[model samples]
Target: MTLTTALALGQTALKLGLICSLTVLALFLSYSMLNVCDLSTDGCFTLGAAVGAAVAICGHPFLSIFAAMLAGACSGFVTAFLQTKLGVESLLAGIIVNTGLYSINIAVMGGSSLLNMNKTTTVFSMMKEALSSTPFAAQTELIIGLIAVICVVAFLVFFLKTRLGLAIRATGNNADMVKSSSINPVFTTIVGLCIANSFTALSGCLLAQSQKSVDINIGQGMVTIALASLLIGGTVMGRGGILKRAVGMVLGAVIFRLVYTIALRFNMPAFMLKLVSSIIVVLAISGPYLKSQWPQIRRRLTHKKGGI
Candidate 1:
């Protein structure tokens, strides 16, 4: 490619990278706090879009975003209640909530499987209008996404520093220890989950507004994607303090997006996307284990060196 064409392509890639990174950051917070393997993300994501689109279509774009957050929070509460009160397994609870939300999402779209918001009053439209005179229209979404990610990262960092936030993290790390200290782990779990789901919903809402449409299956495999992002970030950044870990998660999401974008650019088969995601997750989750094993090899090598 010519030099000018290469620069243009590079810029496009960078923009896409930012979008994906922010999205992953949002998902990382949801996963870490909730301790919920939320299959419901798939349905709730679509639900957010449906709710956002429905309201935006009626001329209230901002309201739609909040409405979507509410919908996601409710779903999280139900799953938590099922797990904590009804003694349901976490996975099963997520499955039940996810299944129910699927229908609810469809209903929100007027019983249709999708709702097109093209030319409708979406969040992006408002943003575009506000910046209409600027040449930044083409890069608006990327800029907004970066800002949102920064806000989310800051919020999460501040939250984890609060007394309640510390308690919640302790509960996730050690339920028995929290219980011995006279704190109810269940409460922390519920609250954490609610927060996580709300974040997920917010992402969905933003995505819908950005795309100006809501499709029933738009959220399919979202949980996996989120997990992939979290793992990628954690592995690369070395999860440390609350702020660092949170930031890492966002970076991981961006990296995940970059990987996907590169794969697509190379025209890799669609079927391999899931496979690649799974591999990334596996590598991320197993990173610590691999690190621990390294010492054994090092010890053996040292012994041989001394003998020689």
Candidate 2:
């Protein structure tokens, strides 16, 4: 590819990577730290996009962000309630909430599956206008994405170190231990999920604005993407401080998007994209385990060869 073409592709990947990394960060908190596989992520993400777009379309661009987050928190609260208060299993609770969110997302979009923001004054448009005269004008989306990711990462680093954060982490590690220490696991789970889902919603909201549209399927398969990204980040960074690991998550997201962009460049059919995601997820999840088993496999092979 020509340098300009490559640059364009890289920019596209970077823009999407930064935005979607927010979801990965959410998963970092929910799955890695809180040890909950929140399947409602896909729906909560769509809920955010729908709410944010609806609010922005009504002339409250900035308010849309908070509105989306609040909606996401409520979704998280419900999922948490089901698991904690209603005696639902975590996976089942997430699934039930996710299924319910489909109708709610449609309602949020006024019964439409699509919402056009072409004429809307979204945050991205606002930022673009503000930087119109500057050399950085073309980088408006990048700037906003970087700002959001940085803010979330900073919040996570600081929040995960607080007493409540410690308790949440403890609950993830061992709920019984946390309960024995008088810390309520239920409360921690709720708090962790609320925060995590808010991040997911923020991700969807930003992506919607950045694209100037919101589609009902905008968040489909997001959980898989986030999980794969999280696994990739963990494998890359192994064990580290929160900040380091968080940065690794961002890097993993960028890497994943870059690969995805490359696939698109190869003229891969749009229908095959999901398969690519699934394959990437499988590789990310199994890569470390396979690596760990290589030595034993080689030893077994050598022993068999000697006997032969």
Query: Could you say which candidate leads in lDDT?
Result: 2
- Per-residue C-alpha lDDT of model 1 across residues 192-260, encoded as one tens digit per residue: 777777777777877777777788877777777778888877777884897888778777776776667
Clashing pairs in 1: 21-254
State the lDDT of candidate 2 residue by residue for 1-308, as single tens digits: 99999999999889999999999999999898999999999999999999999999999999999999999999999999999999999999999999999999999999999999999999899999999999999999999999999999999999999999999999898877987898988999999999999999999999999999999999999999888777777778889899999999998888878888988899987677567778888987788789999989999999999942
CA deviation > 4 Å runs, candidate 1: 1-27, 286-308
Total clashing pairs for each candidate: 1, 0
Q: Which stretches of candidate 2 lie over 4 Å from their true place?
A: 291-308
lDDT of 1: 0.75
Provide the lDDT at 141 for model 2: 93
The stretch of ten residues in a row with the least summed lDDT in candidate 2 is 268-277
**Highest-scoring model, TM-score:** 2
